[model samples]
Target: MEDINRFGPELALLIAAGLIVVGDVTLPMRGGTRRVASVALGLAGLAVSALWSLVLIVADERGNAFDGLMVVDDFSLFFNFLFVGIAAVIILASVDLLEKSRFRAEYVALVLTSTVGMMLMASTVDLIAIFAALELQAISFYVLVAFLKDGRSSEAALKYLLLGAVSTALTLYGMAYLFGLSGSTNLNDIAAFVAGADSGTRPALVLAAVFLAAGLGFKMAVVPFQMWVPDVYQGAPTPVTAYLSVASKAAGFAVVMRVFVVALGHGLISSDWSNMFAAIAAISMTLGNVAALAQSDIKRMLGYSSIAQAGTFLIGLAAVAANDPQLLLGTSSVVFFLGTYAFTNLGAFIAIIAISNKIGSDQIGDYAGVARRSPWLAAGLTACLLSLTGIPPLAGFWGKFWVFNAAVRADLVWLALIGVLNSVISAYYYVGVVLKMYTQEPANDEAFQPSPYLGLAMTAAVVGLVAVGLYPAPLLDASESAAAVLG
Candidate 1:
């Protein structure tokens, strides 16, 4: 029992993935077996997550684990639970979508495997562990993005693979440099070596760091490395799109936070990295918003929107480098924003999936007069869109407000101001979606019936958005504790 507890939540997901594969292959034929298998996998995942959370509550404060390859600190634990929760929600959301498509078993298995990969990424404190975990997630996503077996899906997967391979190679090369410099792959050892190194070695270390940053930046979809986002988001399945927007992005941030704050913060590296990140943040936000303004495809628009959000998260990272109290605030803000963003984005995709099933379109015009056809879905979408717009009393507003407040507190007042302006600019497009849903008359007054599962998913998301907007204290507090663990 203690040994099982030692492996903690990570084992649950791996076991669940294995169970899903075996059950799919061994189960006798039944009418709803596929759905049952998916549900069982989700339940198993949830159970593991709950147990892991309990461990976090009950376990001692010792953070290091797995021979210092991982850390079971509050920061990692927070994201561990978050990844599991998101995976569970995705599993629920995927049931209807998967049943309608072929390759149901493979989809469920891959998602579970991806969740496990993300969990490992969040917990690890070693560079080798980071690379292995990232590959685990990346390989699963390659299959997931191309699961549809369509030309567009194939193209998206190929593009993602080619780019991902390059990033991986770059990251590996960077790691080799660090390993050569420190003579160890352990993050703690690397930090100590950098702290003690002379000026002669600084340039090499900086170069390696730059390459590593670029590789991770691609994962976060930061500017100059975000070229693949719109196409991948537009071409992948809706559920995969949601997963990419939420789980994958969160995993990237987890690695960034650990790598920068814990590993690099103790080094002799100059403060120049902060300025570089500030520049990246500015470019990412401006470019993402500007590009999104022209997108007619809803998924592509959301993809660009996600890029802007990535910039905001980077602002949090920049704050950490400044050693400002705002780092705490920024960490909390990022966590809250990610939580609400997951719910809202997933809600929007749920609506899209439901409507697309009925109308077979992903164009913005297809959403016109959606309220008349499916009021429940339209209303849910309205809430999500409003949240995305950062409208008052919606979940997104508070997330943005906290994030900008952190930037201001960190004395990046200009960045905060720009973010606010971008938030306002975003409102135009989000409201356009809403107005099209409510004001325009449907070309055909055809009634739309939504799947019961999808309807329930949307309902839960709507409730989440409202509830989180009204009372953000609990989530904020949790994030605050998580941030302290990082410190």
Candidate 2:
């Protein structure tokens, strides 16, 4: 019972997956099966997440479970909750899309399984565990991205799989090198080994770090490594695109924070890897913003925006590696930024999906006269886009402010400047969408009726974003406390 309690959340998700499969096989019914399965899985996920939150509040902060493969520290607990929250939102927002597209029971099961993988990735402290969790998540996403069974979805899945395989291979090769050097797959052990390594061996350690960084960068959609993002986002189903944009990115960053801050803290600060991250930070920010300015497809533009956000996040990593005394603050800033990004991005995507469903297109021009057809959707989209543009009194503004402030405090003044400039550049394109929505005239005289479920979901996201933006003290405090555990 105690063992079960320890792994309850994961077990719950696993059971949810099982129930989905069993229900699909046994019931073999149509019409409402998809809805039933999706709701069941969503409820199970929410229950597990609630339990995990309760555990975080009641249980002691523990580390090193499963023979040191996992760690239930504050960092993991925080991110576990974040992923679960994102999953719940995705599930809720997807109901209308699934019904319209006639998705099967497998869709729910795969989403649950992928979420479980993400939770595991957040909690694991060993290299092997990270690899396993990553692959599990990747496989699920590969299928999810291609679930539409259309030519475009198929092409996206192929690109995702091929690139994802290469990234995994690179990550594994880097892990092997690290194992060879440190003689252990445990992060703690590797850190200890690197801490006492001779000068000659340090260069090889940096090389291994570079390789690992590259692999994780691919997942985060950082520049140069972000080649697959635009295609994948454009071709994948809208819900899958939202999942990839938020939950998957959060999982990647979770692993990055654990591996670097908790596992390799000492080694990274004392080695050349810090400079590498700094360089990557500079280049990624410049490239992502520049590319985003040229996009007309809404999803493709968001793909570039995602890459730019990743670059901003890299500044946090650079600060951590530099041993900036404000590491906790910096980490908290990143987490808060992610929360804000998720809400705004999801809200924007929700509106996009609603509009696309009505018009059957995702081009920027399709958003023209959105205000005339659906004022509520236009308002939601405007709020989201304004937030994403970092407008004051909105969620995105606070997120970027905190991150840039943290960067400045860490003495990365130039990085902060670059981040500010990028934010300004991003505003242009973000507002462009709003302009098209409000200024241009509608081509047809038809009223747009968004699905009630989707409208509710978008309202929730928008309200959450505004609430968080206006009152961020509570969330910031929680993030700070969670980040303190890494120390």
Candidate 3:
């Protein structure tokens, strides 16, 4: 019963996914009606799970299930809420776009199923379990990316599948090495082994870390391993792109923290991984920003932008590996930044969805005089872009502030400087979009309104963004508490 209770949230979501499938097959309904029904079912499941997670948080419930394969704690709970919330928002925002699809119920099922994997990724403590969770998520994404069945979507899914296979192999090979070194799969046991391992194991450990970093780097969309990002983001459905940007990346970082901070943060090789991540961070930021400067497509631009933001995230992860007094701050900064970013990035994409639904174009030039076309959408997108630029009194600003502060505190001043410069470089494009929206003349002045569902999603995201920006303490404190669990 205790084990079952610990698994409640996942179970609820899984049951809902199953029911969505069953109802889709069993019930007779039109495509549009079925999509609405599926969305309702999916949202109900997410709500139940989210409420249960809240109950656990309030009761201070914490425990390990499956003999420590999966753990329920503050860290996992934080991500649980985050993943569920992202899934709900994505579902809501996708309904209009997906209304005409024949298999919309399957779409919702895939989202719920993938979200379940993401939650497990944050909760699992065993290498085997982590691998399973990652695959569960990746496979669902493979299908989601191609769900549109258009030529571009098909090509993107193919590329994603190929690259994803390579990453999986790399991750598995690294896990093999770690198991060979530690003779265990459980993170706690592995940590115990790493603490006492002699100097001879250093070379093998470094190799393992390299492979692990490369594999996870694909999911996080960091440089060199980020070749697939622009193409995939451009080709996939916009709502899927939004979900990938926030929820998928967060899960990758969650696993990185687990494997790196929990299992490998012992005395040996700490500096090695820190230096590696710092180098990757610098390169990713510079490359991503430089590449984003020339992109004409909004989705492609955001794709490159996400790579740069992922690099900033690594700044905090690198700081966590510093093994200094700033460890807590570093981890918490990463968590808090992810939260704020969820609001900022999702708002940007949701607004884009609303705008593009009417304009029927993704080119940056198409956004000209959007303020005149749809004032609310222009304002929302502008606010999100400003946040992404790390402008003051906005959520993105505080996210960058905390991460950079953590970097400075951990003595990564050079890396922090690189981050700041990249942020400046990023502003050129982010603000360029804002400028085109407000300053340029409209090609045609046919004003349109966003659908009620889209308006609700955008309003919720923007409100969260502004609220978090004005008073960051709640998120900051929550992040710190979650980071403490890792500590």
Candidate 4:
């Protein structure tokens, strides 16, 4: 009964997914009615799942499920709420975008199912479980990216699929090496073996670390592994791109932190992985900001910006220390950042969806005079952009504050310095979008109204941003609690 209780949230969502599919086929609706029913069914399932997560959150008792392959802990519950909230928002933003799309029900089902995979990724304690969860998330995204059935969408899907295959192979090989060394797939057992391994085994461990980083790094969009981001972002539907930017990256970081911190954290080669991550962080931040400056398309620019954001978040991983009194600080910073980032990035994308729907173009110049067109969207975008630039008193600012503070506490001052400098470089591009919206001439003078769906989504994100910004203590405490259970 306890095991069943622990598995309740995932079970709720999986069953909901099946019902959504059945409703789509059996309903008597046609065209728009069918689409609306599909969305309603999807949202109902997500609501049930989220409410179940809340119950688990209140329970707060930690233990394992699925014969120890899955763990029900605060950390996993934190991500459960986070992923469900994200999927709900994505569905809200996607409904109108999909009004004309064929197979709309399947699209919503995939998103729901993908959220299930991400939640499992955070919940799992075994390597095989992790891989299965990751592939489930990736496969859904592959189809989501290509849903438009256009040449660009098809091309983007192909690139994403090809690269994803390579990443999966790397992850599998690395897991094999770890299993060979520890003679177990369990992360805690791997950590025990790694801590006592001899010099000869150290080289193998280092190789495994390299493979692990390369594989998981692809999902997070770190520098060398980031080639797929801009193209995929530019090609996919805007709402789907938003989902990729925040939710997908959050899952990647979740598993990365779990694997590295739990399995390889106490080994002799720990510093080797830390130093390598430090270098990757510096390069990814610098290059991502520089590359973003060259983009004229808003979606593509944000794509590069997401890569830079990943580097900042990576600092938390590099700072984790098993013996330190402030060990939770680094991991907690990531949880907090992801919370705020979900609001910040989603605000930006929802605005883009609303504005682009009106103006019918994604070029920066097309956004000129947006304040004159839609003051609500313009102001919302401004808040999110400045927040992303790390300005004070907004959600984004607090996010950077917590993470950099974590780094300093961990004695990673140099990494924090690089991150700060990169912030300045990013400001130039981020604010340039602002300048265009306010100062440049509008390509179209007439203002059009935004859809209510978009308006509601944008309002929710902005409200969350302000709420978190004004009172960060709740999220901070929640993050600390979530971080406490790491192996």
Best by TM-score: 3
Lowest summed-lDDT stretch of 10 residues in model 1?
265-274
- Tens digits of per-residue lDDT, candidate 3, 333-432, equal 9999999999999999999999999999999999999999999999999999999999989999999999999999999999999999999999999999
Clashes of 2: 0
Evaluate model 1: give its TM-score: 0.95
C-alpha lDDT (0 to 100) for residue 376 of candidate 4: 84
For residues 83-174, what per-residue lDDT tens digits would candidate 4 score against the true structure? 99888889999977788787888899889889989999999989999999999999999999999989998999999999989998998999
Decreasing TM-score order of the candidates? 3, 4, 2, 1
Q: Which stretches of candidate 3 lie over 4 Å from their true place?
A: none
Off by over 4 Å in 4: none
* Model 4 global lDDT (CA atoms, 0 to 1): 0.88
Clashing pairs in 4: none
Off by over 4 Å in 2: 100-103, 268-271
Collision pairs in model 2: none
Model 1 residue runs over 4 Å out of place are 1-4
Q: lDDT of all the models against the reference?
A: 0.82, 0.82, 0.94, 0.88
Predict model 3's lDDT versus the native. Answer: 0.94
Give candidate 2's error at residue 53 in angstroms.
3.3
Q: After best superposition, candidate 4 residue 292: deviation in angstroms?
A: 0.2
lDDT of 2 at 68: 79
- lDDT of each residue in 152-220, candidate 2, tens digit only: 999999999999999989888888888999999998888788777877886677777778888988888
